[model samples]
Target: MFEAIKLLVGVVSLIMVYRTITGNCNKYLAFAICAIWLRYFLSAFHTITYPSLVAGFSINALGSIGVAGLGLLLIPTAVFTLKKLFPFYVFFTAIAVSGFVNMQIPGTINVLVKWCYFLVLAGALFLSIRCQGQNETFKKLLVAFVMPVSLQMLSIVLGEAKATEADGSTSYIGGYNHEAAFSMIIVSFIFVLGLVNRNAISFRTTLFTVAVVLLVLVNYRTAILTILPIAAIFYFTLVEQRLKPSQKAPVLTIVTMVLAILFFVLSLSMQERFADVGLLVGNLDLIFKAPMYFSDAEQDIMSARVYIWSQYINAFTNADLLHQIFGFGPDSWKHKFDLYAHNTYVSYVYEYGYLGFISFIGLMAYILTASFNLSNKPLGKILAFSLIGFMIMNMATMPLWNIEGLIFFALALGTVFANPSAQKVSKEIGAGHKTSMEIN
Candidate 1:
């Protein structure tokens, strides 16, 4: 039954893609973004709900094929170059070099291929925007994302959750593999929607948001912190703009009190779970120290993230110069350790090496700078906060390490560059070049 629902969603998305190809709808770029999201939804749903390893692998492989095939079909419709996209270009180069150096390693080769596929997918989306206007293309992107995510989130209510916690508490993963990943995707989507519709919250939007927050409360408690910014932004949109100068302070006070009460209630409900969070906070200083110095008790904190992170960093530090520079190929952690790095910074540095890490950081910094500049505009502000939230998530979890994280990165930055200001600059530059050519 569930399989049929998945097929139906895929078919509908393809129909839209078909219409766009036929010129029935010019939302080619939007459909490209949808293609990636649909791939993630289908792959994740199948992998988590069913226990068949072979079937899961097949679904993921097919999803990759679909994404690549669609990218090939749409890329020819638009043109872009890697050099102009400086951040991604440098980062891509670093990964490629690392992959070449570690070509014999199966994991590195796999990582290299996936990165290439994602880069092509992103390029196709960018080209599509160049062909169609950014505004229309972005609106379609929003619908493409929000609609599918809404369906996936519906699993929170309809599907049975699994026991993800040792306490026997159920985790509402919404059919995704892990609650953390599920929450990240949901929060990012809500953040994107809030940013696009920043002026006011509709009744439907409020309900959807409340439902998501409730899910977060049950599944990943840490995401609750991430949602604060979204809530603040929404508050400004819903109340700050509408209030008079004098009325603003009083209303803000009332809202603050209400939120405080609500937060207090939430904290009480999750007191037991939050004990680990408190321990991590209390031992925050340990993060600055060398992992070798950690006592057994310290290593056990934050679900052993501290110990895991220390091990990765220690391995990198102990490696020879060549491995130190390029790191041990992609997914190298899998070869050396039993668990994931849990920290993206640790993961990148260990897997890609210093050069790859620097390139990745440079890429993220470039994106954040672009996002920061967009804060002045209405739509740009959404892009800014979304990027911030994604970075915050990376501190503990590896969002960029998986397809979901990459999807958020592409969607957020793609929308950022697609904003009117960015597009206008490109247009002016093109016009200037054209005029110079005419004079020549």
Candidate 2:
């Protein structure tokens, strides 16, 4: 049954890609992104049916090749402006230099090419919005995202695959490699849907939010810590326009305090590594101290993330000047450590070096600043809150390390930096508000 479902998804995704390429669908980039994601489901199904093929999967890997191909074909259709993409350009350059310096040319090239594909995806989105307008393009995007996500949600409920945690709790990971990754997809979908439904709250939106919250709470308890606050903020933002200025501040403050308390209590209920949240809090002093100073017991806190972080930090500090500047290489942790750096900050510094690290941080800073500047815009608020939740998730796990997370990142970046002109957005929104108010 799962095999049949996976095959159906693959066929549908391929058809979408073909339609996109032939100009039958203006959602060319959306379908292209869909193809990349659907490929994972197909690959997972293949692996399940034939475990022997697992070895070959890694060897034959061409990361996001599906999107890259479509993106390349669409290049002429879209103007490849770099003004909004300047930070990405710098980060890419730094990583490429680091790859060459560390003699990890093959690995670096693979990583660089993968991101370049996303750049093309961003450009395609830019062109789509420019040519078709934001509302129409976003409606298409909702369809594209919903088509694949429906299958993923189905897998979560009915698929045989499950993730067993250290404490013997089993998480329904659906088609994803990890529960957290699967939940990231859910969160991304929710935020985008919120953007689409920005005109008003509806039964569908409310129900979807409730379902997503339940899914995250059961499958990935830690994510709820972030998602709860985000969802609360989103609810407040949507309703704030209805409230008088005098009511807004007190309502927000009271809700925030209540949610904070609830979040604290919920954190203590997490299983396995996440249950160590209190232990992590108690060891704040030890965490900031030098890695070498950490005792064995203290190192074991937070699923040994402290120890893993220390190892990466110390390794970087002890490296020669060139290595320190450029870092070991993309994914150097595979060779350098027994465990992956659970922290994105530590991992980037170790793999990309300070140059790449600083560039990446600058990229994030740009997104945050841009989001803040456009906060009054509905899409802007969604991007800001979603980005905040994503970044907070990264403190413990490397969301950027996987395709699902990168897909969200690409979507967020593409939407934010793709178009600088808000005139279209304003006109559409003004028109929408007039119509809505008339009906009301």
lDDT (CA) per prediction: 0.63, 0.65
Estimate the overall C-alpha local distance difference test score of candidate 1: 0.63
What's the count of clashing pairs in each model shown?
1, 0
Q: Show where candidate 1 strays beyond 4 Å.
A: 1-24, 44-57, 76-79, 82-84, 120-139, 142-159, 165-167, 198-204, 214-218, 244-268, 288-296, 420-440
Error of 1 at 420 (Å): 4.9
lDDT of 2 by residue, 1-95 (tens): 86677577667766654555455346555554454455444444535532333434342144365566667776663255556677888999888
Q: Which segments of candidate 2 are over 4 A away from where they belong?
A: 4-33, 36-40, 43-60, 77-79, 145-161, 198-202, 214-218, 244-265, 268-273, 285-296, 419-440
**Candidate 1 residue-wise lDDT, 1-440, digit = tens:** 64556556656666755554555335446556566566555655665533534633456655665576666666643334534376776776777677678763556655655665566556655555556645445444554444345446555557746676435677765455676666666665665466444333346357546645655644666566556656655655566667899998989888878777877887788787667777877867666567778888887676677778778888888889998898787776776799888888888888778998998888888777776665246455556666676676676777676665666666666565544455445665778843121100
lDDT of 2 at 48: 54
